[model samples]
Target: MKTDSQLQQDVMAELKWEPSVHAAQIGVEVKDGVVTLAGEVSSYTEKLNAERAAQRVQGVKALAVDMTIKLSQLGKRTDADIAGSARNILSWTSSLPTDAVKVLVEGGWLTLSGDVEWQFQRQDAADSVRYLLGVIGVSNQIAIKPSLSATVVKSDIEAALKRRAMADAKTIAVEVKGADVTLTGTVHSWAERDLATRSAWGSAGVRNVVDKMNLV
Candidate 1:
């Protein structure tokens, strides 16, 4: 395991390497295994990319994002324009249902809320708007309304995991309480952990997914 200082340095280096991020404007701090990002960026997309870059570094257990977006005069867009663009882009996305996601923009921040049947659709709604001009931030409040029963949800998620051939599929325990699913187990890497979590969220009728998975 890397020390806190070493992890901080690696995160900073990673941020600098990512072309989308203005790393010089961002500050990195690490303690224990948590990374806290501070300072400012040119846009919301850059901030998201910086956070993703930090997560790609090894030994990042958690993240605290304190960075803010400071859009240039030319980059600024009115809330109405941002909302209109978000709506137009969302309508263009095939994966998302027509008007299934509602958009709210305030202070250049976009918030999406609605119900979708699967996690991918909800994710698509957010992805469609993140790159829009003048989007300072995004809040995806889209909820999942699974079409399947509780029993079916468990079986379906397990089957999905097996189909993906996750090495720890057997060790990963799946629990469904009402529309909520909880995953508990150990995986070898963040990739596997994310895969397992996605499997749970992919199931029909999974309103919420609780990840109790730990990296081994």
Candidate 2:
């Protein structure tokens, strides 16, 4: 196992190599397998790039980012313009909900807050800010609100399993209770098993998934 300091150092090195990051302005610290990133960048993309580079490192179990962005380059734009741009990006994306989410901009730094149905929506909202030219950085404070419905959960599990199953007779069994979906069956590889579980997570109204699938 790599020490926290070692992990931090490795992540920093990786960030430096990424063309999207202004490595000199970024600061990284690690403790108990959690990496904390602090620094200022010129764009939201740079902030996201720094965090992603850290995530790719092997020993990083979690991340805590406190990056600031300065959008001094896009001069003369009102705060409303910045906020509206962020909101437009979210609204254009199919996965995100514009009404449920809130976008705030202060001196070019954008903060996003709201509840999304899927983890991907949360990530996509942040990514949209990165593409905007005037955004200095983004603070992603979105929450995941999994729905609570057994029927939806069961349908999600079945759909996920059906896609990955070798055939209809694979002996896969799916059960859903509340927001939890349980899968029990045998698959040829761990990859297949994991894929099935991930598929269930992609569905709406699923809060938790339990996989008892056996790999042979």
Candidate 3:
């Protein structure tokens, strides 16, 4: 285990190392095992990248982000322009269905709403729009269509977790009610906990995942 100070150093180093993030503008602080990031960022992509970089540090138990987006003069885009760009990009994405996702932008904040068959498509829709030039924030409200029963969904998630090389699949419990999943158990680290949750979301009809998992 790493001390809070060591964890803070590693997270700062990771922020500096990630090419997409502007580490100088961000501040990192750790208390116990939780890491909090605060400051300003250039774009929504930078914000997401910063969060991911912090999570990559070995001893980060949890992350609390308070960064705000402050677009430079050259980076500004009208909400209409952002909406149009988001629509165009979603339309071009091969993985997403034709016109399945809808876009709305307000004050540089973008929101996606609609339905998709799989979680990856829903995720891809958000990913495509998140990197747009003027996007400050993204809300992925796209829902997954329910296509599997509780039993099948549970089994599928369990199987996926077992297949992951580093995950102790037996330590996690998967509870499904229709398309909703609740994960409850203990994992070795934050990475393992994330892997378990991702495995849960990978199932066909998981519309919502409630993570009640605790780190060891």
Question: Of the candidates shown, which would achieve the greatest TM-score relative to the real structure?
Answer: 3
Worst 10 residues of 3 by lDDT: 162-171
Please tell me which predicted candidate would have the highest lDDT against the true structure. Answer: 3
19-132: candidate 3 lDDT, tens digit per residue = 999999999999998999999998888899999999988889899999999998989999999999999999999999999999989999898999998989998999888889
Flag regions of model 1 displaced more than 4 Å.
none
TM-score of each: 0.94, 0.58, 0.95
Provide the global lDDT of candidate 1 against the true structure.
Answer: 0.90
Compared with the true structure, what per-residue lDDT tens digits does model 2 show for residues 1-216? 889889888998999899989888988899988889998887666777888788777777668989977766454366688888878878888877658678888866789998878866876888777567676657888776756677766765676667665453256678887666787887654446557777767777665678787644
Which residue runs of candidate 3 sit more than 4 Å off their true CA positions? none
Candidates 2 and 3, the one with greater TM-score: 3
**How many pairs of residues collide in each model?**
2, 0, 0
Off by over 4 Å in 2: 83-130, 136-148, 154-201, 206-216
- Candidate 3, TM-score vs. the true structure? 0.95
Poorest 10 consecutive residues of model 2 by lDDT? 161-170
Between candidates 1 and 3, which one is better according to TM-score?
A: 3
Candidate 1 lands at a TM-score of 0.94
Model 1 lDDT tens row, 1-216: 899999999999998899998888999998988899999899888988998899898788888999988999989999999999899999999998888999999999899999998888988999889999899988999998757788998999999999999999999999999999999988876788889999998887788899898876
lDDT of every predicted structure (CA atoms): 0.90, 0.75, 0.92
